[model samples]
Target: MDAAYVFAVRFRLDPDRGVAVEPETFETRLRRPADDPGESGWLFFRDNLWRGDLADAESFRGLTADALGVLVESVEYRALETDREYYDALREAIAADLAPFNADSVDEVVSKYLGSSVEIRR
Candidate 1:
């Protein structure tokens, strides 16, 4: 089955300041793990919403823990594999999760919060 994976890292706001800034703070590039390709989904989505099932939740958790070391505090694992009919459902799930942020739409939210743009890797 063709599948997709989304992984994210969240940071607590600097308490001294009232504003929140989400930056990619944990460094995994130094770790010499041949298999680890550090991909972050939090910054990719303007809303930082996730909707999917994990193929192997425990294994994913372990990989994330190993990559981030002490900084990773919690993780949510999901599994989802959908054909044509369920695509809208997945989108709805994403929207519902993002409602709390009062975003007019995902694109607007992502553009504002994603910070630096990424180069697409084919």
Candidate 2:
């Protein structure tokens, strides 16, 4: 019963790019306990998300206990797709939730994740 943590955070770019979806969103995929069904596949959705793999719910709770004092405004979390249905379940859920907010088409999601931008990387 493999598990992972997904984080969705909202950030504001110093120089506005005229994009409607704020600055940029970052998602962190991390491995976690396999038997912890209580809080398996935790997904953090927040203004400034801070999520990662932890031993137990207590560990996860402790991480967010203190504010990092950045531009972060809020944080949200939930048990995402479990190991059994992780394949399509998590992928579909992410698409469905991010489709409306993404600036580019759904097909480009992967490319965007890889940091493929109009400006070529040297």
TM-score of each: 0.25, 0.26
lDDT: which candidate is best? Answer: 1
Q: Per-residue lDDT of 25-49 in model 2, one digit per residue for the tens?
A: 4333333232342233323322212
Report clash pairs, candidate 2: none
Q: State the number of backbone clashes in model 1.
A: 6
The residue-by-residue lDDT of candidate 1 on 1-122, one tens digit each, is: 12232344442223345665566344222211111112243222322323333334455556666765544544543222233333343345446566654668655443344322322222
Which candidate number maximizes TM-score? Answer: 2
**What TM-score does model 2 achieve against the real structure?**
0.26
Per-candidate local distance difference test: 0.38, 0.36
TM-score for predicted model 1 compared with the true structure: 0.25
Q: Which pairs clash in the backbone of model 1?
A: 46-110, 53-78, 53-79, 53-80, 54-78, 54-79
